[model samples]
Target chain A: MKGMTIIVKTITRWVKLFIFLFGIYVTLTGHLSPGGGFAGGVILACSFILLTLAYGKEYALSRLSLKTAKSLDSIGALIFLLTALIGMWVTNVFFDNVLQKLFPGTDFMLYSSGFIPLYNIGICLKVGAPLFVTFIVMAAMRIRINDKGEREIIQEEEEE
Target chain B: MFITEIYLLVLLVFMIIAAIIAVEIKSLISSVISLGAVGVGMSISFLFLAAPDLAIVQIAVEVLLLIFLIRATLGREIVSEKGAVTIPLRLLSIFIVLVILGFGIIAFRNLPEFGKPVFSLVPEAPSNSYIQHGLKETGSANIITAVILDYRGYDTLGEATVLFTSLLGALVILRAKTKKNGTKVINHKETKARGGE
Candidate 1:
């Protein structure tokens, strides 16, 4: 039984790794493709969902706690807000082009662009963390009905 | 017909079918799934209309809303299984459908042709510098990104807030709050507190 659980956990972990990598690829190519922060975030959330489904809510939550997810969400939002505010100070408008001084003379290199990548990273974290958190909370709260028609909260089993 | 037009027509038909299913389905879960199909159809239509951002957001919100709604409605099953349509209700639905169809026909006629360049009537338009700078400065090759993140930064901020608010609301609604009595009300408490309590 333990060996079976380990195999299941390994498969789930690999699936999650694939999803995470795919999400990163989508986010990086967002500027050129149909995918963006939102798509990437959803893809990332799917990984968490997959893990939860494979190993149950307790296993998933042990790896990513609600507190950590909430903190990441708050930090992402703060970073996004601060980036816009910094732009306001430099160019007199929120989210203005403040990175022009960093790379002078129409440098169109990928890294040359100012806060777009930063914004993408913030959005990725913002969308991914909350989405996963919601999934975890929902899955944890799910009432399992047994053959005897009893509603059991699975999370409480973890404490036992 | 061109491929784009064909795709649009197919999407339109699918949307109509999904809407019909959403109305006709007796089960709430089936209805919600049908509604999701409708949302996907609409998002495809948005993509056909050259609004990918709206499509992405629409799809995301629809999925999130569907999950949230399903979770909320899980315990409260719809009791009725008759699936009967009353006469007065049917007539009212028909009346509403006719009104909506009439408006839709009129709106369809008013829309511009596909692939035609939108002509600006006003002379003093904002400079395209913002868009150009967005492409150059944002490192994002997608023009939509430039428009969303740079040209209309404040609007994006508002969108982010909406996303945040929806998540917060979902969390508040779905979170398992401990009872005031301090007794953990979930199952399997014996094994859980065996060591400590």
Candidate 2:
């Protein structure tokens, strides 16, 4: 698919950065605000999705390739696991708020929450990358049901 | 209190109308769009009910779901394989639905009053403790975040793992294929196996 019209492309170009920033804001201020990791991550994915819808699939892949997205997904999961493991090592209990024990940060501040923001960031990456990857994969696939009731899957040709 | 109830009534009515339209619409695309309207209505209702967190999640998820559904339906060759439903089958299904709805209404009546949780019956419930000490213990202003990431961290961890696994499964299942010698083969393995096909 060649994507939508020029008007959409122009609007998307203007709006994409703001959307990314908003997602980061939501994830970072999760402790002080309503939205958290999952919600913020979805917003982040939506930014890339807007880009894909406006500027075609090839442009999106060029910006964030499937391989890189897969790696980011793994890395995000690892970071979350590492945070939990570190907590266990520090407090002798799994998933404990070790930072709180070490140094209780002041309340309502951005950095105050003990490891919650870190978890949010990790989860943001974990959720965002996979969602974007899922969209890309789904968009690339062309599935049809033939008259004989057989399923046919066709992979879209890559732009040279 | 009276105004709030009126607002909620309006929102609920809107949602019900949208839901009916979603079900009865002949065009698949129109049906999907109406279903999205139902979701957005639900999100607005959540906002009115003092749950902005749920509202945000609902709207975001709704957008993604709408995109996916539209992608599946738009510009696609849709084949309706199933024949028209028999009268008896339709009547039986409608009866089953009515019975389920009746049971649901009964269950709803048995629920505790609004804003008073059944957990209140148990004074020593963990949710009670969470509310009492959530902010103080976790130093997070949002008690919900504190509970999810701190008090019940294991649950969040499990949820993340589940999401990770499911997405990974989807990617593996949808991995692209290439025709090699007039036979379809997964290109993923070949790329890694030969450093490039």
On TM-score, the leading prediction is 2
Q: How many residue pairs clash in each candidate?
A: 4, 0
List the lowest-lDDT window of 10 residues for candidate 2 chain A: A151-160
What are the per-residue Cα lDDT tens digits for candidate 2 across B116-142?
A: 998898899889998888877888888
Interface RMSD of each candidate, angstroms, one decimal: 4.2, 4.7
For model 2, the DockQ equals 0.30
Candidate 1 lDDT, B54-171, residue by residue in tens: 9999999998989887777677665557777899989999999999999999998877677642343323434445444655555556767666766777887787888789889976
The local lDDT score (0 to 100) that residue B59 gets in candidate 2 is: 100
Counting only residues 3 or more apart in sequence or on different chains, how many pairs clash (N, Cα, C under 3 Å) in candidate 2? 0
Please provide, for model 1 over A92-135, each residue's C-alpha lDDT reduced to its tens digit, 9 standing for 90 to 100: 87787587546533333455456766676677778898899877
TM-score of each: 0.60, 0.65
lDDT of 1 at B25: 82
In candidate 2, which residue pairs clash? none
